[model samples]
Target chain A: MTRAFNFSAGPATLPESVLRQAQAEMLEWNGAGASIVEMSHRGPEFMAVAAQAEADLRTLMSIPDDYAVMFLAGGATTQQALLALNFAAPGQTCDYVVNGHWGKTAIKQVGHYVNPHVAASSEAGGFHDIPARSSWQLSPDAAFVHITANETIHGVEFRDTPDVGNVPLFADFSSSIASEPIDVSRYGLIYAGAQKNLGPVGVSVVIVRRDLLERAGQPRADIFNYRSHVARDSMLNTPPTWNWYLAGLMFQWMLAQGGVQEFARRNATKAALVYDAIDTSSGFYRNEVVPAVRSRMNIPFFLPDDTLTARFVSESKAAGLLALKGHKAVGGIRASLYNAMPVEGAQALVAFMRDFQQRNG
Target chain B: MTRAFNFSAGPATLPESVLRQAQAEMLEWNGAGASIVEMSHRGPEFMAVAAQAEADLRTLMSIPDDYAVMFLAGGATTQQALLALNFAAPGQTCDYVVNGHWGKTAIKQVGHYVNPHVAASSEAGGFHDIPARSSWQLSPDAAFVHITANETIHGVEFRDTPDVGNVPLFADFSSSIASEPIDVSRYGLIYAGAQKNLGPVGVSVVIVRRDLLERAGQPRADIFNYRSHVARDSMLNTPPTWNWYLAGLMFQWMLAQGGVQEFARRNATKAALVYDAIDTSSGFYRNEVVPAVRSRMNIPFFLPDDTLTARFVSESKAAGLLALKGHKAVGGIRASLYNAMPVEGAQALVAFMRDFQQRNG
Candidate 1:
């Protein structure tokens, strides 16, 4: 298979090794008589897969003993409202730090369930930078503080995990999970859609402090209630068994590649190469995200001549680097350097950009 | 590769053709140079897949133009609450015809959001029979009338779709969908998990009459509202892309195999073979479900000597037939003959049953 560098953000690229292994075992998993996609979730074949996946993920993240790890359906978008509906008491405020589109969306979802307090926002500057931690007007008794650790569209990331003081810090780690080692003990909850660094779409990994699970509202819809899922070990329903199995494969892949630290190093290198290309382009390319907080997962850059963006995307596709067109919300080009995109792919993109700039210039 | 006859209730068997096709395309789908699972849901490649899948499903079911078919995350379990929350007005009654476990669970979930009227129930008889339409105590002005067309665990099926008259009849077609030709226009809504006769788990297909979409509640958590999903073409969130793709394959497979009519015939033949084995066993093996409404998909039977169930399950596995153990809710053996399970598989099971009974009777 002549594979290209796939850069589309979440339902994003996965380890080629994982995909190869999935292909090899698609019809019969581990000498079992049925495919992973076709195995009963309750049976030993799949239950062991689900259990191993959860355990591997816990070890990769160094998840604390008090945390409950769940592989849930409904992506980060669902988790946004679930967090507010479950965490906030009646009339309590849900605090949000909105640096990008996903954060704004989370606030809107939360506002439907509870009044969301926008503690800090970078929307005024077209979300070109992550807001300073000191600029955050945090509520002293806020029910929980929410943040999108890596903004996919805006290409901004938290340089350091913020200190939310006493408020439970809940994070949408969708774009950056497993790209770095996170201090799981500090957050009340961390959810990441698997499509981005983990595996495929539809499955999300949620790590919630066990005690905080009690704070979730009782009257919420049964499936929406995390407690229902936690109670059943995330098999509250059939679950995306194939996705869960693929995730287990990905967890093993990460472990084989020397865990999260190695992934973090590779991710940093890929991000730097693409960023360097944009920086040395002599004003031809510009990425507005503050260099200090530039995202290592998604990097969005612009051509000085906006009309050149279309040609660049078309030409990039021809050159075998896929899905570089930026989101309409943040127009230009976005090269998402998730864990699966090697530094070599980034170097190829940089080479393409240099050639394109010279010819267009 | 030695494949087995898998009788798992769900996440069950799949066509070898589909599995082979999926394996071939796992690394690079349709020359796109990326796994279909890795493609962006919004991209042309994936969107084309989504559109084709919807079109194929619509054709297979003969779904009318007025219905909005959506691919949604969370399984049938989530649909339980979503049906009540999306269709019923606040404080209005919803009527349910409960024939088995899933139906009972739906009623319980609906009761949390709206008062559900138990219009009919066969639970009084241990769910061995479907409640008769004549004995139903349906509320006249119920927002909707709900039924489980086929109960997987109980192995009971509605011989024909009920005429609920003015009330919108919403059917959970989870186990029975695509098993036969049905009048899609007769029901207000039909939703099914893509596990049994469709595809793998994680995604469900909801076919709601377009007019009913407006009946959704005003203050719903955005993701919970059907309207939110309808507006976005079920891209309300990332959606279960892998499940959707697999369902597309299943839809194609169904279409190629002469669609629902052909499937129904094969299913009838398969169910008859298994039932014939039990019926001819002379008090050794028994099925409690009233034969008139016996399921074409799930066939639950009892052995006179209950202690032999484990031996039957184990010996069946050894003989290359798998997962014949019945649900814990009702103990014995259940052979789920979904569309993917060939008639030959059932014939093999029947032959095995005859041999086992002769040796041990």
Candidate 2:
């Protein structure tokens, strides 16, 4: 079967090896007499699968012992709401450093639960770059300072972690997680929907400092309580077992490929190839985001006109490349170079860009 | 590939054909160039897949136009909490009928969000039978009357929907949905985790009357709002796309097998085979639940003592029966006969039971 190079933002591409492995075990997993998807999460078989995934992730990310990790259901948005429910007192102020669409969404999710203070935002600049750390209006008694590690739609990313003094830092690392190495201890909590760099949709990973579980944040249902999830080892209820199993397969693949350090080098090379193609297009293509903070994981670019943009999307699919359409909020073309997107895929796209530009320019 | 007759509770057995189809399409889906799991939710390919799944489910369940259905991430517990957050005002009274483990857990999830009054409970009698509807003490001003349609652990199921007067009836149909046909208009809302009767572990189906979305129950995030999810067509955020697709496959399979009426007949025959074995065992085996309300889906029975229970579990596994061990709360044996479990599987289990009793009695 022919598989194309898919560049959809989240719920993005996965490693072919992982998919093959899943197919091989779809009916009966390793003599357990049922597919991993069909087994009980609390059963010894799935429990071992879940535990190995967490242990491998901890090793890959170098997570500190003071932190607890959980694999939960739903996307990153659910966690955005829970951040307020599990950390802040009712109507307590929480600092938000807005970079782009996801940052704004994070704030929108908790408006009723917390007084969200926009400490700094790049929205005025059309989200082309990160706001300067010095310009942030820090809250003295804020529950936590929130940031988007990468914005999938706006194509912006944080180049470095900003020091917010004594307040804990919370970041949405959905798109760029595992693309490179970062200090896990720098943030009080890091959460990501597993559809992007991780394996599949329906499950999210939350890494948090153990002490934060004692915050006594606000009155809410037990399902929304992060501490309860941690206590139960993310089996607070029937977890997304198939998704969790798929993600665990991803962790194994990542470690076997030399961990994040190897991925970081490859990511830099792939991003540079596509950016170089855009730079040399001589007005045929333009990427609006500022160079300094342009996201390595997702790059949104534009053709000279909408006519050419439509042609590019249709032609790209014909050329065995898929999902290059931009977000509806910002129409054009977007290429996501998540961990699963091979370097050769990026190279192929760059070659196609030059050929298309030569014909149309 | 000697597949066993798997009898695990929720996250239980699946139709073998469904697993084979999924395996065939793991690498590429319907010539879409990428696996369905690897595509964006907003893309046209998945949009069609999602739409078809919903339509098939509606047909299979005979859902009416006044009901809005959603396929969401997470299991029934998440919806248990959201029921309070989206439909009831903070501290508004909600009447609950508790019969078993799941019924009590549902209450535990919503304790902080609503005033959960236990209107009737069979827990005092070890959940051996469903509480009599005539004896219920429902609240006059309750936001809703909640009931567990079937208790998976205790093997107690409601033979008919209770008429709870003017108050809207909300039922957790996680274990027994689609096992039989019922009038959709009888309940204000019905939610089920897809693991048991539906399909897989990660996705849940929520069928709610349209008027309920207008309630401004309490302050909550945009993601937590039912109105917003419905407006976006359960696409307010990235849904568990793979789980949704799998459940869709299940719908197609059920339709091909002549829908719920056929399943109901098969289920009755299967339940009779097992229960008859228990009843005729002359005290070697025992099922304490009232026969009239005993679940056709799950049959939880006890051996004469602890040693026999452990021996029966081990011997059953060796005889190609899997996951017969009971839940920790109530230790014995449980044989879950979901829609996916074939009639032959039930017959095999009965034959094994008769042989086991002869050897151990």
Which model scores highest in lDDT? 2
The sequence of per-residue lDDT tens digits that candidate 1 reaches over residues B206-245 is 9999999888553567888898898999997898988899
Local distance difference test values of all predictions, in order:
0.89, 0.93
Let me know the TM-score candidate 1 reaches against the reference structure: 0.99
- How far residue B242's Cα lies from its native spot in candidate 1, in Å, is 1.7
Q: What share of the true interface contacts does candidate 2 keep?
A: 0.86
DockQ of each: 0.78, 0.88
Query: In candidate 2, residue B256 scores what lDDT?
Result: 98
Candidate 1 local lDDT, residue A147: 94
Q: For every candidate, how close is chain A to the native chain A in TM-score?
A: 0.98, 0.99
Off by over 4 Å in 1: A216-218
Task: Tell me each candidate's i-RMS in Å.
Answer: 1.1, 0.8
Over the stretch A52-75, how does candidate 2's per-residue lDDT look in tens digits?
Answer: 999999988999999999999979
How many backbone overlaps does candidate 1 show?
0
Q: Which stretch of 10 consecutive residues in model 1 chain B shows the poorest summed lDDT?
A: B214-223
